[model samples]
Target: MNKQHGSHEDKAERYELKQTLSTLQLWGIAVGLVISGEYFGWSYGWAAAGTLGFVITSLFVAAMYTTFIFSFTELTTSIPHAGGPFAYARRAFGPTGGYIAGAATLVEFVFAPPAIALAIGAYLNVQFPSLDPKHAALGAYLLFMGLNIIGVAIAATFELVVTVIAIFELMVFMGVVAPGFSIANFTKGGWSGQDVFSLGAIPGIFAAIPFAIWFFLAIEGVAMAAEEAKDPKRSIPIAYVTGILTLLVLAIGVMVFAGGSGDWTTLANINDPLPKAMKFIVGDNSGWLHMLVWLGLFGLIASFHGIILGYSRQIFALARSGYLPHYFAKVHPRFKTPHRAILAGGVIGIAAIFSDEMIKIGGQTLTANIVTMAVFGAILMYIVSMLALFKLRRAEPGMERSFQAPFYPYFPAFALFGALVCMGTMIYFNPLIAAIFAGVLMLGYVYFRLTRSQRETPPQNEVFEPSEELA
Candidate 1:
């Protein structure tokens, strides 16, 4: 009887992830993984759809993300798996759906880090004239990946500390830039060569959608740390809610301050938007400018390190569940970390950073294009995960749940509707890249179908129950 009731403990032990993360640490992971976006990537939206247009696009993305995060909290708390969206979709839709969710997650988590790594490189180059951006990026990948492989506790602690500093630096940045923030500067290019209601403006906002989404992109990655969290049922919800709120405020403040400090056009596509904006406000060689450039690296490093942690756990979960080769799932005996997964993700990210530099489409650099591709992956997972949530409500009505998504069908429906609009807009503006993303998903599905023999069949009726856990 006691063993039956202690299944949670058994599951925890067997899952292989060390549970050392508190709500604060989880919040750190959540915020740190996404802080870099407020520092960069998002400004590219201005290039696509001027200042006001991008701001409008961001409003839509913000709504989608807010609703999505709330609904997603239910899944994270109820399921509590490192696989995150993959685990939820797997339980709701079985192995095939699981693979699709996992693939989307893999794409989102894997591709995001390289984009941040590139930004890290850009920030370093601003501070160190001798450093090449690519070399700086490669060096960042090497250092952070090693740190992640060493241990999760140390990694999470580092994430918390850096995230706090990054948050503070952003506050300081806003204070310094506030005096230069003219409404005239912010509205200078509100529509960028197209009338507000023109068909051309439609595609402009569509093109800006990815960058808008960048503001809060990987905050959902908090759920990926669920398995490593202490008291996940309680901690996940707190972290998710707090993380989204933090990102929301930071996103609005950063965008408004940066755009108002200078011509939005000039700052639009740069990887170091904050430093550039600071230079506009405080002169090119001012101490404030230099300070921001250095502190800005912490924002990049926070996301770089946090996302590396997310992708490794994602890879580990997929491999352990037989979705990939078993070798990648092996946790380090001493550190209890997913060393193989971390290194594998690092190798892939480094290659992506190099490859993206060589590829360009319609005048957009590899970084911009890859950012779109990653958002495509995230939107796909969002759509699927929302559907999974609805399905599980019906399929597993009797299942225990620590958190239930408020506004139920309405909240999720709104999120789904927003995601679909975003996806359609993405496909409209970048059909070829969208097609390629679809092709990748199709290939993933086919591969999983053919390799069904390799995957171990999980228990039939208890798919949502954490296997090998205490009751």
Candidate 2:
């Protein structure tokens, strides 16, 4: 009897994640998961809609993310599950909704890192012209996956350090370029490359939605780490509220500074825009330009490393819930990290990095298409999450909520509306990627439906039960 009981305890331990993240660490994960947007990907918006037009798209996106974060915090605190949106949707709408949410979140987290990793390689290439960007990107995946597997606390600490440095670097970038910034330069040909806005620019603005969303795309991934937070209910709200505000300021500051520094056209399609923008201001040989090249890497690293952490948790949670193969659910015995999940995500990201040269769609680079696909996943998850929030409010009225979304129905309603608009525009502009995204989700659903009987219930300790009020 004693030996049987010990085996059962060991089985339960295999699925548990350690709780060690504090408020500051949680804030770091929130910002770190997205800081790379200010560095590279958002510049593509300039190519799609020009400066002023993209700005309009950005503001709309910022509004959606702000409202979404405010509303999302309530669910994070109430459920506090590693599955994040998946857990909430499962409780509110059952297995199908949970599968959709989990699959979408997985796509968002998994696809995001490769884009950031490529940007990291681009930054390194600026310094070492002989090195292949793809090789550097692959190396990054290996390095960070090791760090994450070592332990969550160690990973979170590293994320916090890099995130702070990245933020400071952006402030430095704005200050260095301030003297060269010109409002006339920024607004020149600011509407779909035309000098003035016209009815024609409407399509460009809509097309810019994905790049605009890139500016704040993965900020919501913080919810994945809620299960590992030391004080999730109180700490998550503070971290999320403050983190969104921080990214908003950084995104705008970085964009304005880069656009106004030189010919905005030159920065539009490149992965190393900040360094190139700095070159225009300081000249290529200046130490300041060199410094930007080296330090700009941290912004990309912060996001790449942070998103790897996010994707692994999502995979682990899905596996734990039997939505994915149980092979991925095992936590490392000593480190208590999801080793298989981290390695699994890294393999996917590395494959993407390798395929960069072989793939191009709609004349956009692999990085751009990857960014758009990630946004598709993110927007879909956002729409489903908001719907779950509404359903849960009615279905479990007395469910304990340490933090309530301010303005309730209005805030979430607007978030839902904005997400739907973004989704519609993205599909209109990027039909091929949209189709691919849909296909991935459908395949996942089929697997989920066929395997319903084989699904394993998580251990009792891993399950989240509502308070007595829910009874």
Candidate 3:
């Protein structure tokens, strides 16, 4: 009787999330997590670099993601922790490195959603001019946070449906805009600031990296779902490879069509670039225009909802490991989701919505400001993660590996260098935002030092083993 009672207590303490997600659903989460990037943020590249310059920039950024995802797959499958990069870095670099990786990841997952939420609001305002974007943004937060807290199965299912619709809409968008595609139009002002072959054009290409990165910004978010994935060893590789390819196709298609359709400048900075691009291709009165506007919301919703799942898991992992307040680690006994973490993140996102409205820098809106800020965080995390991969490869050579990155050192080294270059270029271009990001990292480190150590020894409540493996 006592043994059974102890076993029940152990299970409760584990906070073990049910592994209900299959490969298709994992693919949905991975793709949905980043599909919104195709719709909005990448256009900003045109502002920094002309149409051709942006395309050039995107090719390099694509290379980085391709290599990084391959290397990340090995660590994620072997470690298979909800902490994602935090877990991998922790294993590689001790507490300080782990904290940096975790903090950057928090910034990436947490900061990403507000931008998507704001885009959702912008899409709504297009339909109903009277509605305030902020109100719609806040409403989305509340509704989705509740859904996330309810259950991962339900939330993931919703993600799958919306992701499918969003993919279809992009296809329809490409079809509508295809005939209008003009090589001359696409190539207009293709090089901005300097000639392509000149040394001076390097800055323009580097500056455009962030916008190009928007195309695949959160694709690595697939790693965050490792804990919930049904057959992580098998499903993760398939999802990562397929997800990046899908985004690559979508990214190139959208950038070319939108760039060529009109004065790319017109849509360069707006949140609803696709709808505006539709206006240029088919004119304003086309029936497809209205449908695209409404359907575009699904793309933003897919990302916003998907990231909520990611941030909550990050929070749960940190809290469970004692890097954060224990409160955030608590799972809802009924739903078995991290209810506290979800609500806490929602509150932060709501605050970010209002803060963006109140703050502006160098004539850039709060939305642009935060998007760059999130990129700052993401690159920092990427630098650490790629290094961790190399470090672990040398340090623990015999670690069990279900999947290995194709190229040993070169792939990860290139990814690491590219991430560093992007970070340096962004800092040179946006010093103030870089300063703010640096301050946040410093403060996060200070807090980590003061916190109790969960790294030295595993907590009794933590479960290091999977509850069940895929057959």
Which candidate wins on lDDT?
2
At residue 184, candidate 1 shows an lDDT of 94
- Give each prediction's root-mean-square deviation over alpha carbons: 3.7, 2.4, 3.6
Could you tell me every candidate's TM-score relative to the true structure?
A: 0.94, 0.97, 0.95
Q: How close is candidate 3 to the true structure, as a TM-score?
A: 0.95
Point to the candidate with the largest TM-score. Answer: 2
Query: 2 or 3: which has the higher TM-score?
Result: 2
Q: What is the lDDT for 167 in model 3? A: 94
Clashes of 3: 0
Clashing pairs in 2: none
State model 3's lDDT. 0.85
What tens digits encode model 3's per-residue C-alpha lDDT throughout 1-471?
Answer: 999999878756556677888899889998999999998988888877878888889999999999988888888898888889988887788767777899999998899999899999999998899999999999999999999989999999999999999999999998998888888877776786467777666667778777888888887877878888889999999988898888888888888887777777788788889999989889888999999998888999999999999999988887776677877777898898989989988888889999964668767767788788889989999999999998988988998899998887888888998899899899999888899899998997777777645533333234332331111
Give a tens-digit lDDT track for model 1, residues 1-471: 898769755543444878899999999998999999999999889888988889889999999999999999999998888889988998888777788899999989899988998898888888787999989989999999999988999999999999999999999999999998999998876887678866666667878999999898888899888878989999999999999999999999999988899877888878888998888889988999888988988998999999999999888888777777767777887798989999999998999888854667668877888888889999999999999999999988987889998899999999999999988888998888888888988887777766654565421113354453211
Residue 296 alpha-carbon offset, candidate 2, angstroms: 1.0
Model 2 CA deviation exceeding 4 Å by range: 1-4, 195-197, 456-461, 464-471
Q: What are the Cα lDDT values of the candidates? A: 0.87, 0.90, 0.85
Sort order, TM-score high to low: 2, 3, 1
